[model samples]
Target chain A: MGEQLRKTPYHDLHVRNGGKMVPFAGWSMPVQFRNGILHEHRKVRGSAGVFDVSHMGRIYFRGPGAVAFVNYLITNNLERIGRGRLLYGALCNHDGGIIDDVTVYHLGDEILMVVNAANADAVWKWASELKPGDVEMVDATSDLAQIALQGPQAESCLAAPFDAAVKDVGYYGYAHVSWEGAQILISRNGYTGEDGFEIYVPTQLAVPLWETLFRWGSAAQLEPVGLGARDSLRMEVNYALYGNELNTDVSPLEAGLRWVVKLKKGDFVGREALLAQKKAGLRRTLVGFEVAGKRLPRHGHPIRSGAEEIGVVTSGGYCPSLDRGMGMGFVPPELAEIGTPLAIDARGALLEAKVVERPFYRKGSVKR
Target chain B: MEFPERLRYTKEHEWVRVEGDEVVFGITDFAQDQLGDIVYIELPEPGASLQRMDAFGSVEAVKTVTDLYAPVSCEVVAVNEALTDDPARVNNSPYGDGWMVRAKLGDAAQLDELLSAEAYQKLVAELGG
Candidate 1:
């Protein structure tokens, strides 16, 4: 093999199912299946789709200082989120630049920090190096695999195979359910802007779960979606992707994630800089734009206002749900208002685009 | 998708078929397979002239955007209007209905440098789609 890439537990299954494997964050992950991204994206929005998100770091934090140390590290209010609740927020450096966006699973006795696959190692190093007294974190990635069953029919699809107790878990809530004779953590939340469940199980049980899901989910037309759809789906909902929307150079506030920043929650990492930026007002703001036609406003393409370069596109592509090309980019606050006319440098040519309201597609089963 | 022996191909995985004086061109099956799903394709207007190997248009798949290169110097004669609405035809029918652009030959001699079907197959095999 040409420089062995790390494989997830479902790697063999993915290949057998015609997943187009691509090198992502050093892992041989499937970008799209044979059915393609548009199909996969539409499937998830219309019904249910499964995703193998096992590459994400499932680092466990336990001990007396677990809550305190995590509280100090993250931007969200971790102390109040008792057990079985999920807190979505970013971990920033002292400079307020977002290091990684993660979902903290509060399990009362312990906490599970689910981080981005690509940023897992660096995040682990960063957290491990600055670890305060008493708290400890262990990388549970190799031992665990995460599977998300997302869409409108997610609950019904999961209700048959998993325990009935799982039905009680509300949005952003989790339950320890007996799945295939194994106690697996199932969370009633997902990234696809759908009402779904994220099942975290032992690595060995991953394949069985995937198999059982496909078998049981077939009635609801559940498809095994890949990252291509995962990306477009998230983009349609305007969920901030780590490398594209959030990065080390950009603060969470600048990326329209100011709601997650807890300045009054006491001294956390990047509080000082965030406070300063808040006082000075954001210079550049991340905004959503709709391309006038089929031309894609690709990443790093310049955002323009009458020949003046205002900002740059971070993520852009065709959104199947919206049936149009759309993208997210940063522009001056003055130029970031909704319906403002904008031009994007799509490859060498200037394409007509305009700032639009967030979430190119809004008919999602997210809150349902 | 069958690669007609009469047609010619480029190393970039584009196929060309001569229709009298004008020529029709499109991405090959291998290119569509590699591209996954073509969501948007931007082609130049009719009557635009291009140099051999010059980038004429761009194709956007859900995963990436790739430039469509001119296999030979030619003037654009027509583009597939159907593709403007449903570009997935590029994936479903990479050879027939998915044809992207037609151009009058700028230098018909350039066809001599194009690869034969067998050679194109060998090139594809070496690249390993």
Candidate 2:
């Protein structure tokens, strides 16, 4: 709208590779390439695909109080996250509703938080406003560009250019490495529910590094993926997208992220509210649905139990892996059973669907 | 954005080809490209009556869902049921196997109001080269 706003470091590279650029998270990002989203999505599921996730926000909390500050801000138990380890967590409002879902990296004395790009400024401001003594919050989002190489062949593909030791980096773990004279943080973490590494390097070095990865990973069948594939991949895994499954109104507990909320971890921002909710029990929780018919349920589509509206779809799409219409949405706890029948009000028509378990396609290398 | 010279197009990007009274209908190549991947398509039921420019079906991609509009009023005689399992055919062959529906046109005069290949190309170009 406003001249289409900003572009990532790989903007020109995307265009050259026949990527269709679209506005997302306030940045111009490639949605798909010449082969299309289905091809890109299958590429990641079958072999390997590299995604330019540079639009995600990266913030560094440094100094002696870094650990304490992060422990106080997020709901996850930071003390349990050892050095070089990463933990998925959430920044919550006082009401226990999520401000943003984030991944925290315990980098020794410092803590690095990666948040949704759209919530970058909001997260930074919230953390700064809470500015407890001795902690320094720095917005490192612009300085870094993230590349995610995900799939079964991800390790072998990334190991070529990166340190051979990277192969041993366990899931949700990271290691600092020197690549082409630049410091890079390589994390064995991804949202695609696959074995992969999220490499964070200097923005100026993004294009060259991307090219090197593509060239070396070619034999491994690593393709340059776009955001469209990334979304479908995550959706298939039932990972919550910020605006979709998570928003100002949805709590981590309601979104099936209760494992991330540490009730025993002394104190945190939203501890009191979550503790209260835990006692009262969740009214509506996120659940997966697979449409029985060809009609796909979409965001804002109402979920019904006969004549009553039980819930609404937060994220829905046709999963290429399953060859079915799948979605994640909030539903009454009573209707969240694995095989419960539900109807999706897709516009004026009612589409038949059934509740299903999370990670709809589980033949992934996520834990492997 | 290939609009075949022999085909007539709608503003919503559907292409209709006349073969006697039966008209073959499919989305234009431009529509397929813009939609990215066709993951699911809800085709109109056989013998269903449709109005000109009305939504006859819908297509779902990974991130978005779009309604497929009728180019002209007709009765759906056939639907591509193969799309239920392999909807990517729309991307692979929008004009051939990806043809969505075959309908008997209610009025052949409506074809005159559709866009020509040159006109559709010009419209797409003006929207953005």
| Top DockQ prediction, candidate number | 1
Best by the TM-score measure:
1
Off by over 4 Å in 1: none
For A21-108, candidate 1 gives per-residue lDDT tens digits of 9888888999988798888988898889999999888999999888878888888889768997988898999899999999999988
Place model 1 in a CAPRI quality band.
Answer: high
**Candidate 2: regions farther than 4 A off:** B80-86
Compose the digit string of candidate 2's lDDT tens values, residues A84-113: 899999999888989999999999988989
Clashing pairs in 1: none
- In model 1, the Cα lDDT at residue A93 comes to 96
DockQ of 1: 0.81
Q: Residue A203: error of model 1 in Å?
A: 0.7
